[model samples]
Target: MSLLHAELRLILRSRLAAASLALLMALSALSVVSGLSAVSRQEATIARATAEQARDLAAVAKAYGKPDGEAGYAAYYSFLLTHDRPSPLAFLALGQRDVQPTVLRVRALSLQQQLYESETLNAEQALPGVFDFAFVAIYLAPLVVIALTHDLVTSEREAGRLRLLLSMPGTGLWRRRIGLRYLLVALSLLIPAGVALVATSAPAHLGLGILTVPAVYLAFWFGLSLLVASRVRASATAAAASVGYWIALTLLIPTLANAAITRAVPVSKGIDLTLAQREIVHHGWDIPKAATFDRFLATHPEWRGHETFEGRFHWKWLFAMHQVGDEAVAPQVAAYRASLLSRERWTARLGWLLPNVAAQGILHRLADTNLVAQLDYQDSIGAFHKELRAFFYPYLFFDRPFTRADFDWLPSYSARTGTASWPAIPMLMLLVVTGLILAAGAAQMRRTGRDASR
Candidate 1:
């Protein structure tokens, strides 16, 4: 305990180390507060939008909610609001939430067109992304580690204390110092996150899960810093090397990997799907009712015998044409989804070599803010869309009138609880690689002690 106190005192004596610790803590706290504010704003926006949506629905009902309201016009004009609420832990990572729409209104039209509609986003705000705890942990915490550890041995040697300290110390002397520094750095990073988690009343397991990212990430940085510091005689050189490594891992490699993934697995199929659906729907207008009904009935044979229509624009035929449009582009939709999943798969595979990417992937997954989360939201929307089709199908096929009361029967969208599966293999690979780097650092530090002892 006394030795640990002495180490703390020594660290405080250095203005750079002390200021770095203070700055990191302040930044972390600020990030938590900022994240909380952003989340609150999002929730407020959703509430307002939901209220507005209700009013809009009521107006539509007032206009077309008559007892004899035609199912076709009702289905055409009435819009249902669907929302993707932010996850409880989203404040910590806010990954893709900034750009993705939280609230959307879908009509009984082409699902593909509604699915890919982009949300309105300010380019300036989105250019830099959110200033969340994940950014502090993944990018900035390492610099703090580097600042504290880069000169751990070099400064002692320069101060003419290394030889004497080595001669007088026990076997655990260096370990004690290193361990104390690591503990301090970890505390500085985790304390704000812990407080935020408690404030939000997040699940205990979730707190533990989020804490793991920083634990492993900080360990990796400390190990790399120690490994470099042990071999380098100059502190400046050590810090430079560590910063170079930081840039490569966090910036260069991820950018290059994303570009390559984009080329390797093209997602332009999403646009193609939309265009094809539009083309099919537009062409269905010119084609005969029998042809559209034929195509729709191929998949939905239950409605095969109910393919009778009287007018040039029958509700049943219109609905059938839209259904056929979606079915026609089903393969493109699958291919587009598959391509996106492929990108995520490749990104996870890259976690084997990059600790920053691995930590980011883990945190985003836990916070339910990654591509998977967005995709899950889309899936929930799709499911609700199916429910919408089913509800209206009975009314349209039988030529039953859709009244204002029937609107109550329309299924309300309950945001699905995101089931972001743990990336076990990627996380395991991260642990193994982090362990190896730490081991190497320990070995190098031990060798330094041995050489000094002689």
Candidate 2:
């Protein structure tokens, strides 16, 4: 305890160490606050959307709530609201939420067209990535570690204490110094995050995993710094080498990997699917109504007898045409989704070689704010669209009136539950890599001590 206390005092006495730690803590706290504020804004937006949707629905009911209300008219004009609420740990890593739409209004029409509509977003703001805890921990925190530990031995040697200190101390001198810095850096990054977890009432298991990620991530950086410090004689050279490693790991490698992955796995099929679906829907207007019903009935045989109507413009025919268009592009849609998942799988594989990517992936997965989470939300919306169709089919087929009371029977959409999965493989890979680095660092430190004694 006394040895650790002495090391702590020594570390604090250095202006660079003190200032670096203070700055890291401030950035960490600021990130947490920014994340919480962004989350609060999303919640408020969802609340306002829900309220506006209710008012819209009430107006629809007032207009078409008569005893003889047309089910077709009600289904056409009424738009149902769906939203992907942020996970409890989302403030830690906002992930794809910034680019993806959280709330959508869907009607009983061609779902493919509605699902792919893009919204206006500021490209400038999102270009640099979100300033969340993940960003701070993965990209910024390691520079602080480098600043604190790069001169661990060189600074002591330059101040004329190396020979005397080596002679007087037990063999635990390097361990004491390195361990103290590690603890200080970990606390500086994690204390603010811990407070955030408590404030958000995050699940205990998920919170534990979230806190564990930074500790492990920091260990890798600290170990690398220790190894560089032990091997390099000059403080400036060690700092340069450490920063160079940081740049390669966090910036250069990721950018190159992204380019490779994107070129190798092209996702242009998404635009192709959208255009194909639109074209199919557009062509439906020129074709015979019976042809549309026949295609729609191939999958939906339950509505066979109800296909006949008096006029050239029945709601059933119009809906069947739209359904047929969506189904027409089913193969393209499947191909597009498969391509996206392939890209995600490749990214995960890259994480094994890059610690920054691994830590970023783990944090986003724990927060339920990754590509998989966005895909899950889309799947949920798809399921609800099917339910919307089924709910109105009875009235459309049987010629039953969709009265005011029937509006009460509308099928409400429940957001997906239990979709946040633990990223076990990436986490395990991270731990193994960190352990290897720490072991190498410890061996180097031992060699340094022995050489100093000689």
Candidate 3:
């Protein structure tokens, strides 16, 4: 215990160790602040858009509201804007939100066409990726760990304490040394995260992020530190190998794998689905009205009785065709959605072996900023869009007056809530890895106890 204390004191007094710890803490804090600022900007944008939408809706009412004004004109002209607000913990992870559009404006136009358009982003900013807490933990923290622990064994040997320390009759010295170092590194990383979290008031997550990213990531680094330091004869070699491995594991592999998955999937099917749905909706003007109504009636037999039209133009026929248009691209939509989900599934599988990827999956999932969460938002958007069509379909088909009163009848956007449920499977995998590595390190430490003494 006294020796461990002496070592701790020695590390604190060392310029490199002190500077490294201070640098990591400072970086982590900066990342948290940056993430919070970015998210705040997004939320403000959403608020402004909501206000703008309200003004737009009022203009729509002024233009279209009349006892005689029809539902189709109002529905067509008025874009009901929808937005997904950032999850409270999004400051921590800033995942697909960078690439995915958070704010979307949609009208009675073919939803398939309007749905996939991404928000204007400087691809350059995103290409480098977010400078958020996820980045710090998954990428930078490992480097910090490497710097802190790469010399654990070799330093003692280099100091001429190897034979002497090993020969000292001790049962707990090795465990004590490893545990103390692990604690120091963990504290150095955690203090900054803790401070930032308190500053941001980042939400308590589903226990997934806590288990998977921060804790598991620490274990991974400490394990590598043990593995490299265990066999190395020199401190310099261990440090070099560990840092190189850290760079390759955290930066290179994940980026390369992501590129490969995207190229392989080629989810441009979303675009095809969009074009297909558009064709069906607009072609209704040229196609026989009866054909459009027949297609709509195929799915909605309940509305079949109302299919008969008495004039050259019935609101019912127009609305029915729109419904048919949406249905036309149903298979394509399913296929496109499947492809995206497949990518997420594969990412999880890869995460099992890659701690960086595993940490990413965990943190983003906790913050509800993961790719799956983005897909969930899209699913919700699609469902709400259907509701909008449903709400107006009756009014449109019945030739009901779409007055100011009817404007309020339009379905408002519903943002998803409570998507931060703990993903237990990934957390379990992380736990298993952590235990196995620590257990292995402990066993090896026992074997090295005498060598350290000698």
Candidate 4:
């Protein structure tokens, strides 16, 4: 206890150590605050969207609620709102939420057209990414570790205390120093994170699960720092090597990997699907209506007998044409989604090799703010769209009048339930990598202690 206390005091006495810890803590706290604010804004936007949707629905009801109102016009004009609420731990990571639309008004029209429409954003602001807790833990915190531990052995040698300390110490002298720094770095990050968990009222078990990521991540950096410090004989060389490693791991490698993954998995199928759907819908106007009905009825065979209409134009035909357009691109849609999932899978595979990527995947997965979460939200919207079609199909096909009471029957969208499960495999990889680095660091430390004792 006394030895640990002494080491802690010694670390505190260093201006660099003191300042690095203080700055790290402050940055962590600021990031948490920024994340909370971003989440609050998102919630506010959702609330406003909900209220606006209510007003819009009421207006649609008032406009189209006549006893003789045609179902086609009502379905055409009434745009129902669907939203993806932020996950409980979203503030910790933010992920792609900053750019993706949370609330969307989707109607019974061709869903392929509406699913990809997003509000324009400031490209510059989004390009840098959100400064959330995950950013601090993944990017900035390791730099602080470098600052504190890069000179762990070299500084002792410089001060002429290396032989004296190695000669007098029992075992774990290096362990004592490294352990103290690890605790300090962990506290600097986890304290703000703990506050955030409390503020957000996040589940205890889940918060702990999310917190484990940074704890393990910091250990990886510390172990690497210790390994570098033990191997390098000069403080400046150790610091430079540590910083260079940080750059390669966090910045250069990720950038290159992203380019490689994108090249390997082209997602141009999204554009192809949209264009094909548009082309099919456009051609539906010139081609015979029977051809459109044939395709539509294949999937919705329940409406086969009701396809006949007595007019040059009918609501049923229009709706069927639009549905056919969406159906025409089903294969493309699957290919597009598969391409995206392929990219995500490749990223996870890379996580095994890159700690930064692994930490990011784990945190974003826990927060439910990754590409999978976005895809899930889109799937929920698609399901709701099907319900919308079902609700209006009776009125459209049977020529039944849509009344004011019928407006109330419009299906409401239920937000997706349950959080994304903890990423077990990626996290296990992180632990294994951390263990290997720490083991290497320990071995290096033993060698250094032996060399100093001689």
Candidate 5:
């Protein structure tokens, strides 16, 4: 205990080490605050948009409402707003939300056309991605670890302390030193994250993810440091090598994997779905009314016996065609989803070798900001869209009046809630890689242990 305490005191007294640690802690706290502010801004935008949407809907009701308003016209002209509310922990990961549209206005028009419409985001603001806690922990934390430990053994030898330190019998001072430094580094990374997360009211599981990344990444660095510090005769080489490894593992590999996966997946079907559905909608103008009615009846047999007086503009016939358009592009939508999932699967696989990406996958999955979460939210929107179609079908087909009372019955939008699950396989692989590096480094240190025994 005394030796570990003395060593930590020595390390703190070093201006360079203390400065590096202080920088890391400051950066971590700043990121947490920045992330929280971004999320709060998004939430405020959603709340404001909701009020605007409500007013829009009210105006729509006043314009479309009548003694016997047609369902087809109501469905055609009215725009329903669907929004995916950000989760509390979204501040931590801040994943694809910037690139993707969280608030979309979908009418009874072809859903495929509306779904692909990206919001007008400043691509430049998003080009670098947000510098949230995930960025700090995954990319910067390793560099701090390297700064702290890269010169550990080399400096001791340079100062002529290695010989005397190891000569003492029956003492595992080396392990104690490593453990204490590890604790200090871990606390520096975690304390700010924990405090900010609690203040933000983030879920427990997401906090688990934040803590998990630092542990795995820190372990990997500590191991590499142990090996490099022992093998390198001088301090400079160890620092250079450690920085190189950090850059290659964190920055290089993930970027390459992203490029490869995007090329392989080819998700142009999102566009295809939109174009195909447009063609289906336009085709409604040419098709015979009875034929469209027959097709609508095929799915909705309950409305078959309704009054069907022929007219130039019947609500039932119009709504039928719109639904047919949606059904027409079902295949294309499925293909688009398959492509997105393929991308996610590729990313998950890459996490095995790259601790940085693994941390990303875990954080996003917990925060529900991942591509998978987006897809799930889409599914929820589709279901609600179907409900909207169902609610209006009877009034249109049976020539029933759609009074203001019916507006209250319209389906309300709800966000999706996907369970937060850690990817055990990838996480285990990270731990294994981290273990191997540390063990190899420790073995090197052990080999040199007796040589320094003067």
Candidate 6:
């Protein structure tokens, strides 16, 4: 305890170390605040959009909600709003949420066309990305660790205490100092994050995982810094090497890996699918109504021979035509989704070797902001669209009028809860890598001690 206290005093007495610790703590806290604010804004946007959607629905109801109202027109004009609300822990890592649309209004038409409509976003603001807790943990925290530990041994040598410290009999001296520094660095990052999680009432187990990630990630950085420090005799050289390593691992390597993944797997199939759906729907206008119904009935045999309207503009036939258009591009849709999943799989595989990407994958998956989360949201929307088509088919096929009461019976979208999950394999690989690095650092420190003793 006395030794630990003396070391703490020594760290505090050093202006650079103390300032680095203070700055890291402040940055962590500020990131939490910034994340919370961004999440609050997203919540507010959803609430506001929901209210506006309600107003729009009411307007549609006012125009078309009557016992004598045409079911076809109501189904055509009434737009149902579906949204993907942010997860409870989303503030920590915004991920792909910034570019993806959370609120979308879909009509009882070809869902493939509506699902692919892009949302308008500010390129300038989104280019920099969100400054959240994950950013601090993955990008900034390592630099702080490097600053604190890069000179651990070299500084002792410069102060003429290296030989004296080595002469001490115990193998625990360097361990104690390194361990203390690790704890302080971990606390500096985790304290703010822990407080934010508690304040947000984030899931208990998820919060625990969030806390564990930083401890392990920082440990990896510390271990790497220790390895650099042990071999370099001068503090300046050790710091330089550590910083260089930080640049390569966090910035250069990840960027190159991302580029490689993009080249290896092309996701432009999404655009092709969208274009195919559009072309099919456009061509549907020139096809005979009976031909469209025949194709629709092939899949929806339940509604076969029931919707025999002779009018040129029957709502039942119009919807059936749109459904046929969606069905026409089913193969393309499957290919597009497979391509996207392929990209996600490649990213997960890369996480095994790159800690930055691994941390990102874990954090985004936990917060439900990754590509998987976006794809899940789209799946929910697709399911809701199916339910919607089913709902209106009863009215359209039976030729029953859509009344105000019928509007009340319209199916509302219930968000899926269990879609996103933790990537345990990637996380385990990260821990293994960190442990191996720490072991290597310990061996290097031991080797340095033996050499100095000679």
Indicate which candidate wins on lDDT: 4
Write candidate 6's Cα lDDT for 1-454 as tens digits.
Answer: 5888988898888888899889999999999898888778877887898899889888888999987988887888888888888887888888988778878888888888788777333457778878989999999999989888989999888898898899998657888888888898889988998988898898998888878877888889988999999999999999999999989998999889889988988776455666787787778789887788889999999987786877567778778888988999998788778888898888888889888788888988888899888888888899999999998988889988888888889899887784456678989999999999999999998898898888
- Candidate 1 vs 3: which has more TM-score: 1
Q: Is candidate 3 or candidate 5 better by lDDT?
A: 5
| Candidate 6 colliding pairs, count | 0
Query: lDDT of model 4 at residue 72?
Result: 88
TM-scores, all models, native as reference: 0.96, 0.96, 0.91, 0.97, 0.92, 0.96
Q: Which is the better candidate, 2 or 5, if ranked by TM-score? A: 2
In the range 160-258, model 4's lDDT, one tens digit per residue, is 999888887566787788888999999998899898899779988778988999999999999999999999889999999999999999999999999
Clashing pairs in 6: none
* Alpha carbon lDDT at 386, candidate 3: 83
- Looking at model 1, report the run of 10 residues with the lowest lDDT sum: 116-125
Which whole-number lDDT from 0 to 100 does residue 149 have in model 6?
93
Question: Which digits, one per residue and each the tens of the lDDT, describe model 2 over residues 334-401?
Answer: 88889999999999999988888999999999999998998899999999999999998888878899
lDDT of 1 by residue, 156-266 (tens): 777878788878756567787788888888898889989989989987776788888789889998889899888887778888888898888889989998899899887
Model 5: per-residue lDDT, tens digit, 75-180? 7767787888888778877887767777777775556678776633455877778888888888888888888888888888889888887777778888887888
Query: Lowest summed lDDT over 10 consecutive residues: which window, candidate 6?
Result: 116-125
For each candidate, C-alpha RMSD in Å?
Answer: 1.7, 1.7, 2.6, 1.4, 2.4, 1.7
Candidates in order have lDDT scores of 0.86, 0.89, 0.78, 0.91, 0.79, 0.86
- Estimate candidate 6's alpha-carbon lDDT, on a 0 to 1 scale: 0.86
Q: Say which prediction, candidate 2 or candidate 6, comes out ahead on lDDT.
A: 2
Error (Å) of candidate 5 at residue 80 is: 2.7
Q: Give the poorly placed runs of model 3, Cα more than 4 Å off.
A: 1-4, 119-125, 199-212, 259-266, 305-318, 450-454
In model 2, residue pairs whose N, Cα or C atoms come closer than 3 Å (at least 3 residues apart or on different chains), thus clashing, are none
Candidate 6 error regions (>4 Å): 119-125, 269-272
- Ten contiguous residues with the weakest lDDT in model 3: 203-212
